[model samples]
Structure formats: C-alpha cells, structure tokens
Target: MDKEFFTPRTLGDAIGVSQSSLKRWADKGLLNVEKTAGGHRRIGMEEALRFIRESGVTVVKPDLLGLGSEDLEVQEDELSSADRLYYALHSGDETRVRSLVLNQYLDGRPLYEIFDEDIQPAMARIGLLWHDEVSGITIEHRAHDICLQVLADLRFRLPRVFTKGTAIGAAVPGDPYTLPTAMVSTALRGEGFSAVNLGPNLPIEALLDEAKKIKPVIAWLSVSHLRKAHILRTEIKELARELREQNTFLVMGGSQIHKLRLDRDPYVLIGKNIHELVSISRGLVANIPQSSESKGEFS
Candidate 1:
C-alpha cells in the first residue's frame, strides 16, 4: 500500500471532532476524503486546517497522541471576501466556488470581478485566518493547490501563430504568495503564450539553469509575501543580470514590490497586474519582426 494512502485518523483525533461529523461533511461534499475497500474514509491535513479556519473554533488536545494536553486557541477578526472563500474551501466545495466564478464569467461578468471579488479576497482571509500556527501552513498549501487546479482547468488553447515569439514563466521567491503566480500563468496562457511554472522556494541556481535550458523570452517573479525580500531580491538580481546577458527579460510583481522601495535594475521590470504583464509580453513579441520570431525554439 502506498504510504500516502495510510489512513489519517490522527487529524480528526487532533481536532477533537467525531468521525461521524467528518464523514457527514464528506458525504455532503463539504469535506474531502478518500475511501478504502472496506469503506473506511481518510482525510487530509489540508482539509482539517481549512475546517479550523472557517469554524474559528479551538481544539485542545487533551492528549497529544502520547504527550501532554495541547491547548489550541482561535482568534476573531473582521471577515473579508478571502475569509468567506476560506470557509468555502474548508467546506471542500471547490466545485461550488468554481461554478460560481464560471457562471459569472458566462454571464459577462468582468474579469476583475472574478479576480478581485472572487479570488483575491478569499486569499486575504485565508492569510488572516492562518496568521500563526503550523495548521496555517496546511491551509496555505491547500489554498495554493486548489488555485493551481482552477487555473489549469481555465487555460484554453491559443492560436498557433501566437506561440511563435512568446514564452512565460512563474517563480515564487521572497515569500511570495502562490495564487499570483498561478493566476498570472493562467492569464499568460489565455493570451496565447506558452508558460512554465517553477513554484515556491526555488533556488537561484536552479532558476538560472532552467532558464538557460528553456530559454524563455520572459520570466515572472512574484513577491506577495515579504518575509524573504532581501535575500530573494539579491539572488534574483544576480540571476537577472546574468540572464540579461543571454537576452531574457525578467519581470516581477506582487504586494511586496508595491510596498517596498526596490532600486531600478534594467534587467528587471515590475508589472502592476496581469493585464500590464500580458501587454508588456505582447509588445516584446511584436518587437521581434516576423523573420526573427522563428529563431527561438520552444521547449
């Protein structure tokens, strides 16, 4: 049996919730689970964290598996759209949330509504809900996983010609949030570019190696979280300088860029949002006259 499939009763026990409640949630599709042949259900730690975030309820582990009692406390804060989405996520209603966004899109709702109203707010609340704790990390991972899944599903095919001179990439350094990178990748695909995503905590050397191999026309660096700003910036600056010599455009953005004062580095450009980034990329493609477009190979 795969170790990943090992039954996870530990999470439920940690939360002090009855197996029945968890099963009921799974049945309603409000909780996600996996079942074994004998009909035993298993849950994920991510789902458990989401549940705690939405409920804002504390669980005091009177017995920490074998150690002493653990006291868990929850905090109250003014809820935002992000929090509402967190609740939905904890409830394991990915389908419902996706349906709502898709329906709005079909009804001619603006992209801004889908992002600003539907997605961004939900992200904010998730952050606040998990401000501190190991469980917060679990919620963070779940949020990123769900967002990436949604973005992948939304990426439709593009015209063949549009792929001739364009490339896209995503990187998370400086504690950047995952949603922005995933969101930008989706947007880039929608605009007819081939995108490559190298997720969080990527080392600078690995980034350089990948870029050299893939040789993307442009790369995106997201900085939603600022915890590692200086270190990430310094490494990225060095990489950008090196990559520029090879003719790659390094673009960056996220909350940190907006808040911090970063010096001008010609090789690096910051985008305010997805629209700006796409427009910039399109311009880069247009600059390379038709005859020059065929030289760069896509990986």
Candidate 2:
C-alpha cells in the first residue's frame, strides 16, 4: 500500500503525546506500526489518525499528519502552491502572493480549504524557520501581513447564507497569533453562519462582553500560545461558565489548547482542526430552528 510514515518521535510531537506513551501504545497494538530493515518503528498516517480518533486525543498539529482537508486530489497542487507562496513571502513579493491566493480562490477552491490545507501549514513551516533563526522577523511580519490581506479579501467575497446561528470568534489575550482566529471566522462564515471575528489578542473580559452583546450561539476561542496558561485557564473557565449561563456553546482550539489540561464539559466543544470546527458549528447550527426563522432579522 502506498502510505506515509512517521517516526515515533515525529508522531508523538505532532499528536502532543509523549514518545514513551506512543511506544507503549505501539506495544499494546493500539497503533499500527511497521519495522524497517534496521528494526526502526514507523507509524502510518492512517493508523495514527485512527488511534487518535479512537483514543479521544486532540491533535494539536493536524497539518503534520495531513488530516484536515478532504480534497486529496488537490493535495499536491496545494503543497506546490504553498511552497511558491512561501518563497514569494520570503522575498516580499506581494504581487506573487496575491496572485497565488486569488488564483486558488478563482479555481473553485474553498477559502477554508485554502487556509487549512495550504496557508496555515505553510505558515507553520515558516514559523519553524523563524524559530530556528533561519528567517528574520521582517520576513515573518511581511508574510503575516500578506496572509491577513488575503484572508480579508476572501472574507469580503464569501457568500453569506446565514442559515446557521451567529458565531463569535477571537484569539485569547496573550496569544498574539491572528491567522487561527481569522481562519475560524472565515470557516464559520463559509459554513453559513453570521460570523463575527474579534481578531487577535483580545482580553477575556472584552470577549465576554462581546459575547453578551452578540449572544452568539457559538463562542470560539483560539489559543495559540501557552505562555500564560494559568491566566488563560482561569479566564476560559470563567468564560465557559458565563457562556453556559447564557446558553451559548463554547468552542476552543489551536496548537496550545491541549496544554490547558481542561476537563471535558458537555457544553464546551473542542476541535482539533478546522474540519472539526465546521462539523461542530454545523451540529450546533442544526439545532437552532430560531435562526432559520429569524434569518432576515439579523441580515
């Protein structure tokens, strides 16, 4: 079978599990692994995903395992596009970046797919370059600006059905990443929700106030950094409680969300990727018969 393989360490890092835990799982046959000629263990991408889904483990890095996007036929094309975009961004080629993004949009690619399968993963790879000191801050900033502009353009062009309930999204304070929130907002919009994006670095109080005002059916928090985990945990707990009182569901995601070590709550939804976010949003929206009745009132 044609398959992708990951080293135990790489798989562990991608899934946020300890290497020892992965080895233990492998030993217990929870994970399907193969032995190389040198007796090194390697895990298949499909088996890893199966284990993750069955074990109820949240994947913090879906891109690493190629799990989010369903458009497999476009995978190679998207990867090539991402590589070109990365090179263009590094060179500060704004024209090329815009053309690449718009071309994908014009070719009938969904905004969420572009973001999830292409832009986000490319940015993540670029982030590694920054972290490793291979790329300077200026290049990173330029790339982010270009991505923001493209996402804004996409948001403007997205067709609004608004059959689903309102969604309010923000990146929690102390998490300076903007793209994750933008992706979530855009995906919600694409999924027929009236999505209000609160953008990045929003204080919990501000988000709470906005949630109260909007009374959104879904309130999404994107936590990209784990620096202020203690503070974030407190804010998230308080916000969840308030949202629960308001009868609004809270959806949380991002790379560092697993770090919070939160206990699962019935009203709080945790998504590992944009696909799951869309799925959760659809489920919640499906139950909101009121939105269907009052669609014209909001628009």
List TM-score per model, in order.
Answer: 0.58, 0.69
Worst 10 residues of 1 by lDDT: 67-76
Candidate with top lDDT is 2
lDDT of 1: 0.60
Which run of 10 residues does model 2 get worst, by summed lDDT? 67-76
In model 2, which regions exceed 4 Å deviation?
Answer: 1-79, 131-135, 291-294, 297-299
Scored by TM-score, the top model is 2
List, residue by residue over 143-176, the lDDT tens digit for candidate 1.
7677666655444312222464445555554454
Residue 167's C-alpha lDDT in candidate 1?
A: 53
- Could you give me the TM-score of model 2 versus the true structure? 0.69
